[model samples]
Target: MRSYGNKLFLFYIILTGSVLAVLGFVLGQLFPFYIVNYFSENNIDLDTDQIDYIKKQFAFIITFLLVVSFILICLINGKLIRNLLDPIENITQTARELTKGNYRSRAFAVGPANIVELRNSVNLLARNLQEIEKIREIENERLKTLIENMGSALIMIDREATVSIVNRQFLDGFQLDLDEVKDKNFLTLGLPKRIEEFIDHVFLTELPYRKQIEIEVNQEIQYKQIYGAPVVGEHGRWLGVVIVMHDISELIRLEQIRKDFVANVSHELRTPITSIKGFSETLLDGAFKDEKMLISFLDIIHQESNRLQMLIEDLLELSRLEQHGFSVKIMPTSLQEVLIRAVELTSPRLDEKNMQFNVDIARDVTVAGDFNRLIQIFTNLITNAITYSPENTTITLRIKKNDEYGIVEVEDEGMGIDKSEIARVFERFYRVDKARSRNSGGTGLGLAIVKHIIEAHYGKIQVNSTVGKGTCMIVYIPLRKKRN
Candidate 1:
């Protein structure tokens, strides 16, 4: 561009100089002829010396004027050339900056109309590019935030099969760090075999794949719904593969529980219904004529009906407790009073089992809970103890308090549960001794109900048991704070 400007300036200078030299030659030629014509018209004669001197003076003047005019015109043309090219040069520089990702640069709009317009266009382009860059940055930030906070674990692999991106959930779920996973080959990240296989399948096939996979972590089984697909860019270019894992362990367990619950309910209901139907039919088929048989059958039917009623009521209670937003009425209640009432209610069962309560009241703790619900919790616990313990066994009831909670423990000298089964005692319809519990008129929902009630009171329950020694049920309820 600079060379082009210099050429243009040189052309102007040459054109101006050529025009001045031609005019000077024409005037000098005509000057001699005109002077000779005037002398001839006036009847005057000129000497050779005078003509030669005048011609010499005219030649010198013409030469001087032409030289001065050419110099002045060259200087003016130089300034004009710079004015023409400066804005263009600025626009070019701005374009270079734009290519280098410097969108903030702008050309100066100072030149002729066309050059200034060009500069303005470049500036406008820079503004648009800057705006687009800003929008892109904002969108990228939004995408990053969404990925980081999303519920499911996400991992992105590049075309080279290297781990390019991983979300927080992915890192935490896999117990991994960014430094360990990033830039590492997907196959070499020590991921679970199942997950790695799935990722490999997607990468090889370059297609979408989905499956429910089981992975063991920390000695526990976890269920994940895995979804993987090949990521494609514009023009259908294959970029990489993305894998998303959603933890569904809880959902799977709940589904299994649902199936078990349906089966259990049907079996439980059928037993008593069959007993009542069989006994009633027997009585109707002439057994009622025998007074002894009739009374015996009637007793059996009455017992079956009672058992059915208890089962139904327990099922309903558990359903309500497991419902969403189920709340218990909370108040400052005397834990000792609640325990006493529960003991009184279960005293009949205690007598039937020939069980004695060893009441150990360390402190009458005040707890924040629903009074009736608290009584119900203890009542069920005591009833379970009495049902499970042998005759003449002592059930110990202890009331104690810690810094933050009121602790109640129901310890019984019963056939203790196995360690493996201890964790499942709170499940509905789960019983350690199914025959004994059913024969003792247990609905099998007592512990489940007790668990829900305690949880509603913002408390926790723990069980400690040995196979032959005894079982201890501990309940921890938050203590009520005193007001000044």
Candidate 2:
């Protein structure tokens, strides 16, 4: 720019100097002719020396005036040219800054009207660019926040099949960090094989795909509902693929439970109904004529009817306990009293099995719960212990306080449950020994009802057992704290 300005200045000086020299030469030549005419017209005789001296003076005066005019013109033109170039120079610098992403830079609107207008246009462009950048930044922040907080795990892959964006849920779900996952190839990130295959399929087809896939994490099976789609931009440009995963393990488990419940209920009901029908039909077919046979058939029918009634009642109780917003009556109740009442209620069963209760009350712990529900919970536990244990085995009942909870444990020397079956014990109609439970007249919803009641009290239940050794049912209930 400086070089250009110098060249322009030089050009202006040369042009001005050339014009002054030409004018001076033409006036000097014309002055000689005009002076000679004037002298003749005045009737004055002039000598050659006088003519030569006057011509010398005239030539000197023209030379001095030309030099001064040249200097004056150069000075004025230099200022004028500088004024013209400075605004353009500023606009040029501003444009350079804009290209470098400095939207705040602006040119000065000085100099001639045309130059000023150009500078104004550049400034307006810069202002618009700055506003657009601000808007873009805000939108970017909003998108970032939404992705980070979304409930489902999300991953975005670029056209190169590289992980480009991973949200917090994705990182946490996969037990990964951003540095470990981002910029890595989608298949090489140690994702579940099923998930990787799904993503790969989407990328290859450039189409939307969805599936419920089973995956194992930390040795536990999980069910995920995954959705993948190819990202297409303007002009149908394939950008990449985006994958979203929703953890549906609970939903899948519930669905399985529902199916099992339906099958189990149908079977359980059919068994007792068939028994009642068969025994009654036998009696109707002249078996009632023999008093002994009639009594025997009637007894069998009565037992099955009782069993069926128990099953229906247990099912109703479980349904009620499992309902939403179901609450237990919470009041200060003595744990010792509840356990004693449960033991008394189940004493006839214990006696029938020839089992003895080894009661150990560490303290009369008080907990906030329904007294009747507490009795029900312990009665069911004790009854189960008797039903599963051999005769002459001692069932140990203990009540103790720990921290904020009153713990009641019903430990029995019984046919202990296998570790794999322990988790399903509380499931509706789940039984370790189905035939034994049916013969013992258990409805099989005892543990399920106990679990719901415990949860309603904001408490917990834990089972510990080793096959062929013993099983312990530990119930933890929050203690009723005394007010100061």
Each model's RMSD to truth, in Å?
A: 8.8, 7.8
Reference-based TM-score of each model: 0.64, 0.67
Sequence-dependent TM-score of model 1: 0.64
Screening candidate 1 with a backbone cut-off below 3 angstroms (N, C-alpha, C), the clashing residue pairs are none
Q: Would you list the C-alpha lDDT of every candidate in the order shown?
A: 0.91, 0.92
lDDT of 1 by residue, 207-326 (tens): 899999999876567899999999999999999999999999999878987898899999999999999999999989999999999999999999999999999999999989989999
Tell me the tens digit of each residue's lDDT in model 2 across 275-369: 99998998888899999999999999999999999999999999899789899999999999998899899999999988899989866989988
What TM-score does candidate 2 reach?
A: 0.67
Q: What are the per-model numbers of colliding residue pairs?
A: 0, 0
